[model samples]
Target: METLTNDKATLEVQLSTQQKLIANMREELGICKEHKAMAESQSESRGAHLLELKAQLEDAVLSLEAAERRMHDGELMRRRLHNTIQELKGNIRVFCRVRPMSSLEQVGADPDIQPALDFPPSDDLLSAGIILSAPSRDGAATLSKHVFAFDRVFTPEASQDAVFEEISELVQSALDGHKVCIFAYGQTGSGKTFTMLGSEEQPGMIPRSMRQIFESSQGLRQQGWELSLQASMLEIYNEEYKDLLSSKKLSGSNKSTKEGFGSQQPSGEIKKHQVVHNPDGSTTVSELTVVDITQASQVDLLLAQAMEKRSVGCTALNEQSSRSHMVFTLRLEGVNEAKGKRVSGVLNLIDLAGSERVKDSGAAGLRMKEAQAINTSLSALGDVIVALGNKQPHIPFRNSKLTYLLQPCLGGDAKTLMFVNVAPNIQFAGESLCSLRFAAKVNACEINHRKKG
Candidate 1:
């Protein structure tokens, strides 16, 4: 009986051990399945993200290809559009602004650009709604804004309060129906962009201008006047233009410029995209962005996009040089509060490319070619000024990429203001003179305002 009892106990212990082994296997299997599911989910998510990145890359490539086409074939398109451009001439007003002078030694070798002869110094600037500078404790930080109207021809280092406030008035004038053009022109290292569109850390004329527009619009509205606004943002890179406001997938194969003037290219570093003009006298510029905003944030959003997609390239003078021209145009179509009639106006904020000597640029191969193209375009711009000054029957506006692209603004019915930026360096004196001379000529360009018949 004792032996039988022992056998039964042994059998029971073996069965119990077998059951424990099965349970362990089941738990292990479950864990493996759960882990496998999680791994698969992660893999799928990664795959989607990769696909999105691929799409973005493809779009960028297409834009690049389109840019290449414009650089090579732009001349052809320009010839085709030449007739249409001549047929329609918009109002363009040129205001030449010379940055106040700063000493080369004190400014650590910057440039000083002179304003044109249009402004003559007078003690009674208050009549122009201008404020002259009173000495401040902060030395010469900068004109916080273009607040003063000076025929005095001060350097950029003179008065911040005067500079910004004057520019603000210029902005107000544009919104008030005078075609306005404001620009920054100077040497390669001059503060051309700084005076017009300051660094990311600092906001220059454009921001200041926008603030004034909003404020002006607000004031107008408070007086029971309403306005409709349209904004277009674009950038010219390597002679090829691109729309900074586009969220769509744009590839060279599927992209095109306005009026079929630009088609896709196979390859290139900088591409040209055509400016898309809105029907309300505002042009969206490219597939990039064309928004009509009654609010300030919308404008800021557009500016952010344009700044992001600016033509930045590696350079010796500026770590990231603006590879092309950047233009932000705002069209304000509003009712005349006093007249109770419809009015139209356009304000173009142009940041022209700084002039860089090819040899000094220190670029190689492709970069060298790019620099050459930029220099050539700028030279042609100079040629245009010379022609306009000569009052020649044929102003070679189509001589270079910059001039051709600027036909609408420079030659159009737009009030134009130019802020010639300077670096205040002795070495840049020659370039400064060149810039001042150009501003003087631009100031002389004729503005034909459309007369209501």
Candidate 2:
């Protein structure tokens, strides 16, 4: 009986101890669950913060990209503005172009006779400064060399595309509301025509310029500009303006008409229109044909028609030679809706008659008269260029009709470029030198811009 009671007491003590241990284990489990919940809550908070930070970082990157683009655009705008200002200052640029030797000129040449012309070394392989060789009177083999510098020079090897690249910026200036004049001054058969009006395979300045203007207009439409272009073609023969796009003229390569003897009248009773210099410093002729040009093809057609009407006569130098100066003018007028401003720009592309000596040209009769007129006008032009270079108080703009009409171009607000073409034939060295000297004088003339509207 005593042993059974002791065993029951021991069992009771063991049960109490086991209960205490169970209570302690439950408390510890509760604390661990609480800590786990708190840890999960903190992890959720950190995940949300990371998402916010990621979004902020992405926004910052986008902002940086936008800023970079804006900065780039600003830089471009700055360059454009700088160019516009330079052009507005009436900086007359000059470029010289040398035609390659023709097969005819190279048919029979002295093997011992060296080339009279040399070009200086230049960074641009396409262009080089001109160096002319003059034979000394002593008859020594050593030739006198004359070197001339120009704004740019194009060798015979230069492509039309390459030549256009140098002047494309000038075309852009015309679109930017500045008057731009580009004329070729050279002897006959010096590739002036080829450079100005290249063939279908290789278009020259007029075609290239027209194409660029039209294309640029399309792009500028986005900038709130509505542009309208008008064109007119005319010939200055015997100091008279003959409408090239006139309906009265027939289309042929060689047509000679005896012009009437008068200051402005030719053989035909073509109306002698009076050229009025506008108060705004622009030239306008009475009874002139101005055609609206909408597309590049229209320009092509107008040019073709003008060429057909141009007075060309066969000469010893050139079979299809320009007897009269042909001037093709483009007037660009635009309205900028954003700025509420009106912009007017004039682009004059001139192909002057070849400056040839009457004796060398083998001209007689009407051809002689034409040659005399060409020489007279060109002399007057040279005089005008000289006066401009000297900054003479009195420029003889009224000395000849050619000078009168080109007053705006010669020494005024117009941005003018004279392309002096030279034939590489050693036989024509004298005439080529004359042309270069004239170009050098013209290059030295500084023109100032008038206030633009």
Best by TM-score: 2
Deviating ranges (above 4 Å) for candidate 1 = 1-152, 199-202, 248-272, 275-288, 336-340, 411-413, 427-434, 440-453
1-453: candidate 1 lDDT, tens digit per residue: 999999999999999998999899999999999999999999999999999999999999999778755653663464335423322321222333345444534556333533222233455622121222222337563332224232225444444445677566556656666446666666566666766666555667777777778887876664445787766656666777667665543443333433212344443233445554456444333333456667776766677767787767776656767777777767777774643556566777778787676555677877676677777777787677556545578889766655665555554434444565544443444454556555555544444432211
User: Candidate 2's residue-wise lDDT over 1-453, tens digit each?
Assistant: 889989999988998998898888889889989999998998898899999999999999999778756764674596478566655543677799998888867777777888867888877532347897866659786777778877788888989999999888778877877777788889988888888888899998999999999999986686557998888778998778787876664222212221101122233544565676767766767656667788998988888989988999987777887999988888888887645668777788889999888777788898888888988988888788767756789999898887787677566545777899998777777678878887877666655532211
**lDDT assessment of candidate 1:** 0.58
Q: Which residue pairs in model 2 clash with each other? A: 258-267, 259-266, 259-267, 260-266, 260-267
Among these predictions, the greatest lDDT belongs to: 2
- Minimal lDDT window, size 10, model 2: 253-262
lDDT (C-alpha, whole model) for all candidates: 0.58, 0.77
Question: What is the overall TM-score of model 2 with all chains considered together?
Answer: 0.74
